[model samples]
Target: MKRFQRIAGYLVAAALVGYFLWFASSNLDIRVLHELLTPPVIGTLIVAALAYAAIIPVTGWAWARLLAAQGESWPVSWLTAVLAVTQLAKYLPGNIAQHAGRAGLAMREGMAGKSVAITVLQETVLAVAASLIVGVSMLAASEPGLAQLPDGVRPVLAWVVPILLLSVLFLSTVHLSPARLATSPTRAMRLLGKAGGLPGARIALPALAAYAFNYLLIGSGLWLLARSAELPAALDLPLITAAFALSWLLGFLAPGAPAGLGVREGILIVLLAGVGSDGELLAFVLLARATTMLGDVINFLLGSLWLSLTRRIAR
Candidate 1:
């Protein structure tokens, strides 16, 4: 049954990617993509790519802080290095690979399997909550009328409310396992009554801050990419940030899409269509994705080399 389920997941992911490619090919002009490679645009893309590289460590720090909350504290540097290599797994076929790779690395460092599980879960919840909150706030600030319009406000609330609830629930659950308790089963079930009652488990303020910075870096990189494409100056920056965040969150939530491929581009094209002609919007989406990929490739190679050298020095 598990095998069947896995196969089904792969098929679904492939279908989603294929559909997006077909749509893109029909609407996108290849000539515009070639045009985007001019010297001025290339300079902007390099800047955007560097911003993306900065985001990797910021996100790793957030996850490391979450793990620290669970009593498996590691230096942010080590965790950042580990995550830099493992995060590339998201580009692979199965979504589980990234988490699984992280789990293996943590276990090798003597972290208990259950603790790793909880840490990953907590980090994901915190990250998503931070993303949604920042995204919605940007939208509201950019267009104050959104606050007055039920139609506009409802959709944002629909996502935000549940995410907020889930974050609270997860935060509560994090307290159940006392960090000092040596035994796993016993520690997992020992729930403290309330927030003030548990010292080890308050709120993850550092994690929230880290994720917020990470989101800002991501949005800024995309903004630079938009500028590289010579998008209209009339396009509002805050609105673009909100749109990117919303589209990114939606794409990440989608089942089976590797690193949110196809889904992210599709959503971006739709949201930014008003910024320019259909072909130009399509070019922006493609170039943004390409610039991001360039950053990822550069980081992955550098991170791998760093990790390898560190291991040799220890020996």
Candidate 2:
């Protein structure tokens, strides 16, 4: 069953990637891409890549804090290294691979499997909540762009309430007290398993804040890419940021999209439709994808180096 699921996921991912390529080739002017290779634009892309890469350590920090909240003590450096190395797994067919990779690596490093599992669940929930918080707040503040979104897309907003409610329920229920668990032990166990525990407010709140900040960094990278494409000055940064955040959420939620590959770009193009010429918007989307890929590569390299150095020092 798992093997079949994996194959199906790969097929879906391949189709999405193919669609993205087709869209790029059909709508984007090749000349615009070449023109964007100017020294100044290249510099901006580099900066944008770096900005995207910075999210890795912050994510690692948040995860580490979660672990600490649960009475697990692991070095943040090691945790970050694990995240950086596994980061590429997000591009794999199933979005779950990255979390699995993290769990596997942490377990190999002597962390309990149950702790890793629960913390990962907590992290996923918190991350999604953070994305919604940023995306919705920004969208609300920038009503003009919200009004511009296609009518079909507007219904997605209705999902916000249910998703938030579910997230809140998961975070709260997972931390049921021992006495409460004992009363409905079977039901609670089914819901949380043996590994369920919630991080305290101090830990969760800060982690949520950090994840929100990471979204800003992600949006800033896209904004930089848009600027590199010489988009119109009238396009508000908040709108652009909100576009990316919402696109990211959509992508993240999508199944078998491989880091939200085609899905994110498609949504971004729709959201920022009037920001620039079609050619420029296409160029900006392609550049934004490239920027993030480059950032992931940078993070993987830096993380590898960190792990290597730490091992050497310990030896």
Q: Each prediction's Cα lDDT score? A: 0.69, 0.76
Model 1 CA deviation exceeding 4 Å by range:
1-19, 143-203
Model 2: which ten-residue window has the lowest total lDDT?
172-181
Pairs that collide in candidate 2 are none
Write the residue-wise lDDT of candidate 2 on 40-118 in tens digits: 8889899999999999889889988888766799888789899998889899966778888888888988998877877
Output the number of the lDDT-best candidate.
Answer: 2
In candidate 1, the residue pairs with backbone N, CA or C atoms under 3 Å apart (3 or more residues apart, or in different chains) clash, namely: none
Q: Which one is best on TM-score?
A: 2
Error of 1 at 119 (Å): 1.1
Model 1, total clashes: 0
Model 1 lDDT per residue over 1-315, tens place: 977876775665566577668768787776777788898888888888888778778877776766665567777777777777776788887577878887898789788886677667667766776777677766665653243345866577667656765665465445443533433454333432211122233546667667767777867877777776787653456666766777777666655776888877776765555556777767777777877787877777877887888789889
> Judged by lDDT against the true structure, how good is candidate 2?
0.76
